[model samples]
Target chain A: GELARAQPVSTPEVEAFLDTLKWDKNGLVVAIAQNVDTGAILMQGFANRDAISATIASRRATFFSRSRSQLWTKGETSHNFIHVQDISIDCDRDSIVYLGQPDGPTCHTGAETCYYTSVPMDEPKLLASTLYALEELIARRKTEEIAPGAKPSWTRRLQQDPKLLCSKIREEASELCQTVEASEGMERTVSEMADLLYHSMVLLSVQNVKLEEVTTELRKRFGQSGIEEKSKRPPKPTAG
Target chain B: GELARAQPVSTPEVEAFLDTLKWDKNGLVVAIAQNVDTGAILMQGFANRDAISATIASRRATFFSRSRSQLWTKGETSHNFIHVQDISIDCDRDSIVYLGQPDGPTCHTGAETCYYTSVPMDEPKLLASTLYALEELIARRKTEEIAPGAKPSWTRRLQQDPKLLCSKIREEASELCQTVEASEGMERTVSEMADLLYHSMVLLSVQNVKLEEVTTELRKRFGQSGIEEKSKRPPKPTAG
Candidate 1:
């Protein structure tokens, strides 16, 4: 008990907690940090004994950087630190999860998390974040070097030429309008929407913006009067 | 249409469009800018005839600033501009919604939109963003001027003391663990959760981070295998 008082967790508390996790052969446990309140899984990393010790000792989420081959404390560079809240192991005990409270975006590219991108993202619930996924991919493409014999991606090519990107957005938007004005139950609208969505993702990617923020805007207005919401806004600073 | 060009819309078309709006006494209409592809509303502003004209002329979102008493283009100073896609008047004609393609976050606080804050937010969808709202509120409290004869808010005081903030978070987190282990569907669990969530938000806000990003991490993992997802991660740079 002496080890548990007056700090986030004492050295013994850290040791006791680490003792519970069933580490892999490499003396590392897969650490998946989750949001404690919402029960939302946040991000995942690897933690060796030292890393786990560092995490509980400091009460910040620390992990073994596989690439660096040493203990790594998240947000060491970006200051987007993850605060360890509660640690739990899976039923099988082969993996561990640290309910981490993150201070800012966790992903390296400044999006929300490291797991934003998913392949074949084809589920109904997953649809909501699809645009965001595309936005992240386009962002990755911006700095990612192409593999030999791989066709150059349009997002990168457009990033090189801003004019084409802007024009493409406008063009796709016009097509969406036409699709909207089409006959009742027009099937073409979905395809047109996909076009617009792709182009808009490209546009947002170029600007280095993520799509989740937009959904947050929508969620804020869920029940409130639009006029009232508008009124509450801090006035935009006027021009000179 | 003098503004007509090889684009999604033309100049005369723009003027004809604005003609449908029933502007208020000051010839202004409330403009709600939305994400064209996602349909998530982005931001809101007031638009006079001149502002609308400028928006069309420049294809940028220009608003009549109430404070400056002049036309202001979004991102004029911050370079976080909103690119106008399509403008449509609401059924009432007193308001308009602009399908905007934002180049960056539209809010002055570097948030995605101006309408992020909500109160007593209780709903299915609102639940996800509620943590974010709390985060934003705590952040605002950090910068808000003290009112005359008002009790100092805990969040405010906690912001002033980093050590106290860290301790408070740890305390609440421990309580949450106890509650979780209680009887099935224990009522105190929710309250403990609220406490932990609040403390976490304060901790994040002090670190200049918001909670929406955390939820995005959850939303992205909606329909995937955590194991497979974990494996796909680009190997963290090793051998530094």
Candidate 2:
């Protein structure tokens, strides 16, 4: 929990006006972009009056192009459009966050998100995007009709036949289990689990099944009883 | 436009980890919820293992309920949930920004956002929501075939007949022009113009037309040659 201990800046009327006032000359504010569906930090930029106005007016994120001294709407050239659901300023009024949906990979590079540098913790956008992509891939699999041992789009293949995909999901899950059983810390355990879950999502997507469906069914069978839900799923087949 | 003069904290990998080591008492991080849609400071809360994991797993914003000391997923109860898209961390490595789509009002009080009070600026989400609601009402008029004069709802009546809505828009524009013609300073003129524009948006939304559509059309018709775009719009229908 956070406490906004800092007193509200005095001079309420002026502060209010300042809050509403658009940037003059060089005034700017930090703007961070995050995925609304997956909970990932995509990128960060700066906003001036022109950029902020454009962003709000378009319901898409925009930023002042410091390099060109002009407005730069993200994905303007790439078409990796981000649709803004909302925007908020921080307590100090120095920064903002744009929460919205992403149309494609946020980073110019092929990565799912912008921040690639390992900053100890994965930047939120990357994680969200990766998960979102996996979800998309999984959903796609459900609609795809393919044959066993046939090379379709990886996702299509996963969906055309469940056996192989299940095998992978089980393999990844076992790996995840190994990490936890070995007493690996949160970082390793989380990383392994993420891989397992992602594969599982991919498997589900290929089948055209929704995670929500599984959740609803689970809830129905268990009725808020996690222990009971776990007890009901068929046991995993032994390693081949 | 924003420049954070705060120097990037650089440290040896080991040193950085050691220096910023938060004891794993609960094994969680602090999450701050700001209204990305409205620029409001909603609330502050924490994420424990279950909270963070559930948020990531579900792709919905979840925070640890400090009072209950358990994982609390926002929107779980209200259905006005924040579907997380991206996340980020401050340089200090202590706090995070969760960006996502808010299902409805973020605050419990039915405000457009969580950080409603004390925020002075005209938040985008508030304006957007108002505009969105107005647009829906307008669309309903066209779709449901309501009668303008006989309709009970003011917005519905205006939308049922385009001519009436157009007349209101013209009246507001005329009033705005009169104010501008009489006003002296920049601030007063700008203020009057904003009101005019806002009313104009309401009128436009009522027609099942978005301001973006007009702007986009203007850009398309007059984007390459600005002069031509201006020449085509019928000179504001000659205020009469």
Candidate 3:
């Protein structure tokens, strides 16, 4: 039954699109799947022509498992499929992006995305992905049961006390403002801003809000600005 | 002069690290370069053993250019070299990360990163990377000269009027609080929070504060939490 579903589609449009791809010698191209809603890059893999065809036809992100040397539909067993809405090829034509919505955590480790681990540094540091990571960690702490006699985590305390969470947000916001008014250097401004972001994220988690929702809202505003700017530009020259 | 500097280091430590890598059939592995300070992933490319060696030895991000069939130092021509501070391999050992500081924008198109293009959507949308993108856009608008007779953009107005900027931040922050106090649904909460985040970023930009600094501060806090948690864990079992 699965094999039948995985069969490649050979429509004229599909064929035309596939023809433009610059597959490597191994007849594979790099394919990256991104969460359309959250904008999190879920995972990356290589896909052969069949995999691409299957992905488009099934609307499920499928990739060539280099180790297994066969096509693998992500979440086939886990049932956390990345249901692709649209696929776009990069300017290079050698890479493809499957903009999709994931049903559950995309990483096998149960993390939302695969790109969680940051490179080690001389001093402890976080990656840009830390925003998403913090969201996940805060969520985990919410449901996690404290060991018997173990102190409740700060996150737990904040989650339990709504007033505390809100107060922290306001307090952090004020500190952020102080940094600006005091003409604090970059370091202090960043520090205060970080505190505010962390506290805001805690409130979001307590309220059962996903960070993706916030990002999606931001994207909407950015797109509106882009549209406004585009309308002011002169019309493009049509192809001869 | 550059050639001498690109020589691969062949120390035992380097050799040991290289041996752990599971290179592809083409003797290459995916190498991602991230800005250590800002936590921005600057670019992704492939690297061989020699490329990795050269990167470690030179402390500059290096990659194997498949098209050119030779080692190439990023920013050799652009002078936007990513000065690597440390390198880390993923758990799979099939990929690597070079965490470094960028001298300037990393993309050839002058974008902060190459991952700016989002997949085409039925409705216009912004990617999660929009936060950094917005910062760049705001910064550009601050210095951009308005064309004669052209209207000043909203960003331009915000930049020119500090009072307006500060007021907006305060207003958005209050709205965000109202969402919580009034029991606003997820949609409204996310919308207000996004507005607050956007305004906060604008203020940070006006203050010449980089988003990376904020992320670094958050990372330091996360690390402190990690350290506290680790101290409580039972010691690992020793090898026989």
C-alpha lDDT of residue B64 in model 3: 92
Contacts from the true interface found in each model, as a fraction, amount to: 0.00, 0.03, 0.24
Instruction: Give the higher-TM-score candidate: 1 or 3.
Output: 3
Q: List the residue pairs that clash in candidate 3.
A: none
Off by over 4 Å in 1: A1-240, B1-40, B43-103, B106-132, B145-151, B184-186, B216-228, B231-240
Give the DockQ of candidate 1.
0.01
Worst 10 residues of 2 chain A by lDDT: A1-10
How many times do residue backbones clash in model 3? 0
For DockQ, the strongest prediction is: 3
- In candidate 2, what are the lDDT values of residues A1-240, reduced to their tens digit? 012111122355534444674343478766667654444566666777556566665767887766688677777777777877667664435556676667888877656556443324333232222334345434644566667875455545544555555555545444444443454554444444344444455544443344434422322222233322332444233222
Off by over 4 Å in 2: A1-25, A120-205, A208-240, B1-240
Quality of model 2 by C-alpha lDDT? 0.48
Error at A40, model 1, angstroms: 18
